[model samples]
Target: MKRLIFFLVLLPSLIFSQTNFEKGEKLFRDGKYEQAQPILENYLKENPSNLKAIEYLGDIAGHDKSWDKAIGYYRKLKQMKPSEANYYYKYGGSLGMKAKEVNKFRALGMIGEVKESFEKAITLNPKHIEAHWALVMLYLQIPSIIGGSESKALKHSNELYKLSPVDGYLSKGQIEEYFKRYSSAEVQYKKAIAAGSTKKGSQMLTNLYINKMNQPEKAAKIKI
Candidate 1:
């Protein structure tokens, strides 16, 4: 009888330890991050080779903005599965967020890390629009002195344009307007409008011509 009781007690613990992933997943889905973390962490401690567990823990840490923990989890996952593009990209994003909390020099390193991750993502899956756009935005935000390249930014922008012409045209127009290329901006904006942009397109066109191009009279003549 004592043996039976001992077996019963140990069975639950054994099951819990082995199938902790299901429990952790349920907790995460229910938004119980605090409860989920420990269970996931304990499971990962023993099964350091479990990519799925590592990925989930990284996701949880990221959602909570626990940058250090998230980076640690993602790095482990990346090391385990070096060929997985998404893993590296996710690690890069975590690093980028953590960088924002640090000095500029450190933040610059984070940006470089982000570029490498996104580049690898693109290499692994050229059709990844999110990674492509992220690279474009990152390059644009960096200053020339800090290794920013306008040409690289434009290249991504053009690729994005080819992938989604309407969105690409509008975004390119916005970039042109930023650089004071009013004529080019106007043409692209108009193209977006004709290509079935939302009402926001009309507003953008009106503002660009009136504010940037200094032609309110012409902007007023444009019909929505």
Candidate 2:
């Protein structure tokens, strides 16, 4: 009778906690993050070890551009679940965004860890397309002096190609364009269009023809 009484006393609180989490999760899924945050935060306070709650909070912080908060949460997630490829990816991405807002020296200092995190994700999941794409952009955007290399970018782009041919061609085209090799970019972009007929590929090709190649007619001729 005492045990039954104890469970009954606990039941209402448990049910309330569950309802709060469900409500918050529903809001999150519905894209109502502002409405979800406080409820999730309250639920997390009561159920501190909830992984999904932690991830949702991290994602909310990331969406709000609260890099420091996002980094803290994602780092915690990484520590708690080291095998999760996505936590490392999110951690690296947060660091990358934060890097962009700081001094050049500080940003440069962060490069190694950022690269390592993304690489770790790839290591954990070889066929991880987003990680491969992140590396591709990372290699292309950084200065050559700070470990950026066209060869390195191309290497990941090739990996993307093997996993996703359309992405492979599009990324390769982006690299060529970055180097002002418009003609090469054109070829790659055309290949991307041929592979997937993606609007992004079409737009890129059209932009290249119009803006870089100074051929408005060619741009207009291509259908989106």
Candidate 3:
């Protein structure tokens, strides 16, 4: 009788907590972060390892550009759910953003962490689009001495091409433009335009014609 009574008492509390969590999650889904944040935070005090709550908290912080707070939540979530590709992507993307705001020395320290997180994300889900985009930018922007490689950037771009052709061509175009390969960049940018990334492609092509190719008339008359 005593054990049965204990179970009966505990069941309602568990049910109530679940209902409460669902309510907060609904608010989160509806984009009411401020209203959802406190409720979720309160529930997480008791269920500190709840993945849903942790992910929501990370998203809230990230939306506000609170990088440190967001990173903390994502770091905890990734630790709890290592196989989740989105967690690694968000964590690495946040690290990349945070690197820009810190001193050059601190930024240098974050580079490896940023790269590793993106790599893990890609490894977990090779078709992850944002992870490929992140890798493309990272490889193109960073110096070769510190692991940057246009070849690697192109590799990811080709991989993206298989998943999303416009993105792939745009990425390759951007990388070529970065290396001042004007003709090649123009070719890929034109491909991107044909593939429906028209606005950005137009801007890039115009910039190339006027700024790099020194064809101002061509830039002015350019159309996507």
Candidate 4:
């Protein structure tokens, strides 16, 4: 009688209840992260290695700005779905964010991994805009001795242009600004404005006038 009673009490905890899992998922989709986290966490305790649960928990960690924890979850997702572009991109982005917050040695250590993850993401999906853009930033920001190259940045800019016309001009504008070619950057930003991305185009052009061109009056008068 004692053994039977124990089995009955333990059955609920042992079962992989779909109802509980789906309820948690609904809460997640509804953007109720606080409510969904514990529910999803409890479900995973009973059903460890649950991929869907792992993915949401990763997102929750990102929302919480717990970059390392988010990276851990994303790493698990990447292991489970090696060919998934989104996982690699998210993992790479989280690494970059964490690198920014850490010491120089640790940030340097992560640079290669961050590049590799973004590379994998773009390889899996050529149209992965963020991955490509992130790579462009990496190439632009790091020193040429390590990996940075304007030529490489330009190549990605061209690729981005092919993928997104608006972002293409904006990216080209940024590259010109990096080289201190203010007039060239202005041309690209103008092209972007003419192409209908007025808001970003206007902001970049305004900054250029005020910061690069030293024309604060012109910047203040400018309108999209």
Candidate 5:
């Protein structure tokens, strides 16, 4: 009789918890981060392994810049779905953010982990555009003595250029500029301007031509 009474009492709580989770999901989708947090916390307390909820919670944490909590949620999600590319990417990005908040030595360690995670994401999904772009950009930012390679950046940049829309010529130009291929960058930026794809392309071209290519007179002629 006591067991039956306990079960009856628990059923409503279970239903209420489910309702809360559903409402949290709806609120999250509607961009109500403040309203969703408590509900999600409660749901996570009850069901920590809920991947969708965990993912959304991690996103909320990231949106709020709560890097530690975001890393925790993403790490949990990654544990559940180790082979998922998006999970690995998010986890890597979170770690990278955390690394930025720390000292240089600690950041270096996290950067190594970040590289591994991003690489795993790319390996899992070769078409993951953001992962590829981020890896290329990170590589360009670091010194060549520490695994950074302008040639590798150019390789990924070319791949991205092929896959990107015609309007993405500015990005291609930026990548070329990073490789010190100023002439190619100038040509790409000019093409973007001609295509009417980017309003800022002319200004960017002016900067690159003057500062990078040492063509101050040519830069002065650019209208925008």
Candidate 6:
């Protein structure tokens, strides 16, 4: 009789907590972060160890560009679930964005941690496409003196190509475009369009023809 009374007393609170989480998660999935944030925060207070709530809160913070808050949440998640690849990826991404806003020297000091986090995510999940893309961009953007290398970028791009040919072509095109190799970029973009027939690929190729190559006629001829 005592145990039954205890269970009855706990059931209502548990149901209420679950209901709040469901409602918040629904809003989150619908991209209504503003509406979801407070509810999720409240739910998290009731269930501090709830991974989904923590992740949602972290994602909301990231969307708001509150990098420090996002980093704190993701760091806690990493501590809670060390083997989870996505937590490491999110942590690295938030850290990288924060690094960009700081002084160059401070940012430089953070580069290794950002690199290692993404690399760890990749190591944990080889088929993780986003991690590969992140590494490609990281290697491309940093100076050569600080471990940046076109060859390293291309290596990740090549890896992307193995996993996703369209992305591979697009990333390679982006690298060429970054280096002002308009013709090479054009070739890669064309390949991307052929591989995926995606609007993004079409737009990139059209933009290249118009902006870089100064060929408005070719840009106009591009078929979506």
Best by TM-score: 6
Cα lDDT over the full model 4: 0.90
lDDT of 4 by residue, 1-224 (tens): 99999999988766646677898899999999999999998888878789899889989988988998899999989998899999999999989889989998888889999999999999999999988888888888877877999998888888999999888898899999999999999999999898888899999999999889999997887685
lDDT by candidate, in order shown: 0.82, 0.94, 0.92, 0.90, 0.84, 0.95
**In model 6, where is the ten-residue run with the lowest total lDDT?**
192-201
Provide backbone clash counts, one per model: 0, 0, 0, 0, 0, 0
Query: Could you give me the TM-score of model 1 versus the true structure?
Result: 0.69
Estimate TM-scores for all models.
0.69, 0.92, 0.82, 0.81, 0.76, 0.95
Give the Å error, residue 222, model 3.
Answer: 10
- lDDT per residue (tens digit) for residues 74-181 in model 1: 888888888887887788788878987899988877787778888887888776777777777677777787667768778888887888877677777767776788
**Model 3, span 131-168: residue lDDT tens:** 99999999988878889998999899999999999998
Clashing pairs in 5: none
Per-residue C-alpha lDDT of model 6 across residues 112-199, encoded as one tens digit per residue? 9999999999999988899999999999999899999999999999999999999999999989998999999999999998898569
| Deviating ranges (above 4 Å) for candidate 5 | 1-11, 166-170, 177-224
Write down the RMSD of candidate 4 (Cα, Å): 4.4
Model 2 spans > 4 angstroms off: 221-224
Q: What TM value does model 2 have? A: 0.92
Off by over 4 Å in 1: 1-15, 165-224
- 27-133 per-residue lDDT for model 2 (tens digits): 99999999999999999999988989999999999999999999999999999999999989999999999999999999999999999999999999988898998
Model 3 RMSD in Å is 3.3
Candidate 1 clashing pairs?
none
Residue 146 displacement in candidate 1 (angstroms) = 2.9
